[model samples]
Target chain A: MRDIFDQIRKRMQPPQWASWQTLIFLSIFSAATAALTSQAPPQIAERIISSLGWVFLILGTWWFVYEPDVKKKLKIYELFIGPWIVGALICIYLFGTWEGRAIPAPTAFVSWPPISAIVWSIPKFIQSDPKTKSPIYTTPTPANRQNIILVLLANLLISCWFQLYFEVQDWLAEYPSFRAQGFEQSAFVRELQPPEKRLELSRGVDYLDAAEKALKSQLEGKPWAEVERWLSNLDQEFPTVRDEAFAQLSRVAENQLWNLNARVISDAYDLEMRAIWQGPSARTAEYSLTKTCRISQARQVSTPEQLKFNSPTPPALSAQQIRSLGTVQCGAASSPDSLPQP
Target chain B: MFTDVLPLRAILFQLLFIVLAIAIESIVLQKYLGIGQKTSIQYAATANLASTVVGWLVFFTAESSLPPSWRVQLIGYIFYDRINSPALLIGLAFSIFIGTFLLKVQTINWLDQILGIRKPSTVEVQDPIKFRGRTAHRQTFSELPNRALGVLWANAASFSAITFLIAVRTILPPTNY
Candidate 1:
């Protein structure tokens, strides 16, 4: 274990070729892969790109820097990484513009320009070292510079294409509304009735409108007196026409009353109601009502023994009859006793 | 002293590096750029001449059968193939050339540093190897090819493998319902 540890320790120390150039190469590769995987739309693309970058970076570094015999070979590999990186960018641009649908202009602006500038400057930086008065400027020759410029122009075209694609997609997804006048004209042709017919149909609209307004106002948290008064006024206004209107109004009122009953039932079941009715008298009232129905049904049963036992029975009753009697009788008998003594 | 012609080991190492570099570059680009794996492989391969012609042939053959989107995707792959893969080959060649020159310089520097050899200002030691000799003299940096043909072949092989894989994936019948 100690020997293995020692070997590992020895390996950690970087060799001669482990300079700023190698570090920058690794960093750039890392950044590129991160950007690709992190920003790429499809999940599969992201994973593949990230894994490939990692595997290549490690292999390239190991081949060039670690293995003594392959040092020269590795250096050659490093040189290729730059151009290949440029190629990758071009591919990204082409795919995005042609196949990937649209290139997001903002993303291209954010990611590509800086990356291009950095990559373009690398050869120049490497060529000009302060220590060496004239370091060899190997890459960024006039020909390479021309290629870079071409790539940049291609990227710009692709970016514009992407923006246009997104705009089209947005247009396709938009909902047609009144503001979309052309869309409204085409889609809602049936909704646009003839103006004279529309006006004729709405001729008696003012009376109906007035009735609706009065009903709405009378219904707004007022006593039944105000509603009755409004109904009477409506009747006086058009005695012959008022019957049908009143019938319709009555149906609406019935629906509202049913809804109110439902709300009251719900409120009774609420915690607030339980707290309000927490007294012994309320509990007794509830119990008696439940019990009275059972007693009344027991009396109504036509068993010979029960009939013989209650020879003076008041009346025979069905289950529903017993329930109704229980409700009426229980309320009448219990209300006074159940009320607060004060 | 004349050495044996450039060692096979050196060539093999160079080829290995070329493959490794391209694979890494392709993977990185695919992972980050949201490009398809198939596209990345194609790009990695056709960046150089030996592979580009083959890639173009494959592309044109596939183009008629594929949808417009796929064709566009293929174009992207081809573009990357032309740029990154070939550039990598060129970079590798340059690095090899530079590394060799640096090694020679370092050797001379080491001798002077360790042996305390005083320079006789009168005479300069000329490089033993010269152009057009039995010994392979290193070419002046200017004379090296802009791109490496050997690296291109390596890329072509990788591209072929990738294209084959894509074809196999597409052609094979589904096993599951």
Candidate 2:
């Protein structure tokens, strides 16, 4: 409606500009804050610090620059948008910028640094009068429109600069191999050594080294527990490497002198365990080797339609109850004397 | 997927999007609202400008902030892996339509009041003696249906504009999405 346009025009026409000193200071502070926070680890402390910095920067800038009448506009803005900004900051803190395992991804676009440019520039745009001699808010001029647009463009550019830089920094952090390769290396140069080959070679070396160490320690008569612990300690494994590592460890355990092979059988939703000794062909004496085994959810074999593997312990066995309910007929042992179990 | 270099093309695309949106809304307003072309154009431009800036700003902010998992989920919901989900797209379109309709009505009412553009109405006394000359106006009631229809047309136009913008953005050179 004409009336709505008139009202808006009236409100915006005689825009007062914040002092140049305040504008300059605020812009510098915002960029600095963004740069600092980008360099810092994505932690709650950093989020909180950046948010508080923005909140104070806006308030402090307004206090130093604007007249009392103009300051009321800032108050209005604060009243309307303040709580949401703070809430967003709190959420950003709670959900640190990480990939998997974070609480439902909280958006960070409304955070302090990204929004600071617009918020700070709004008053500056309103107050700016480039046509005037001193550029102070004395009277509204026709050139005010052009000047305001310039100020807004400046604000947008400054804000975007911070955002782009921060984004690049985030990208660098996410891909640490870029750092390892060194920034001096061009993309074409880097492409000369394929990433897939690099990964394969590195993983191959790691696997060989780990296998050698485990086998040597085992030959020295280290307990099976030590080997198991060492295998488990290979954390931060890529999926392919993890599977390969697990397979290698299993092979080492199987080739041991006092080896125990355990089979987990699930029949009609009932789980049964059976152990067989496959080493030493001539032992007449019976030996019961107590072995501790880990039950992991089988990724390759299990499907949703079949028995689920989410539970840490099987359903057929209670925590306190341990009864060998299922019959386990031992296979013909290498020595007939050790084949007494049923 | 963005090249992480010259984003001039993206800004150009955004400008084209805004111009297209304004044109679509203006045409709808002229045809359905039964308003003059000039007034319709003015209204369309104002409304589109306000909404587009706010909408794109919020959208970019959310896009930049979303985690990979959430982004994947959102992409799945909206595009269904490029097969497209009509249900989701329509739902989003309708939501935006309703929001825009309400905002337009409020702005129009305010503008009319400020410009002293009230429609003249006869005041018919409902009950002269008991209700102290309480009156009723029939003009507003009669005009309601026409206004509602006009708004519905506006909604359709807006939906089309949004869909076009989405398609263009999707088909364009990839951003850092």
What does the lDDT come to for candidate 2?
0.42
Native contact recovery (fnat) for each candidate is 0.00, 0.00
- Evaluated on CA atoms against the true complex, candidate 2 attains a DockQ of 0.01
lDDT of 1 by residue, A1-342 (tens): 999998986775445564534543564666586675656466676666555655555445434443455444435644433433443453454333433455433355334543544454555435666787777655555444444543443343333333333332332232111111111111101122222222122112222333333333333344434433433454353233323333443221111111000011221111000101111111123211100100111123223433454556543442233211111111111212234549
As for candidate 2, its clashing pairs are A3-B111, A4-B111, A15-A126, A16-A127, A17-A127, A17-A128, B2-B175
Q: What is the TM-score of candidate 2?
A: 0.35
Weakest 10 consecutive residues, lDDT, candidate 1 chain A?
A270-279
Give candidate 1's error at residue B104 in angstroms: 50
TM of each candidate vs. truth:
0.21, 0.35
Model 2 lDDT per residue over B36-110, tens place: 786666556555555554455565588678876454334223211232345765686678778777766655555
- The top-ranked prediction according to lDDT is 2
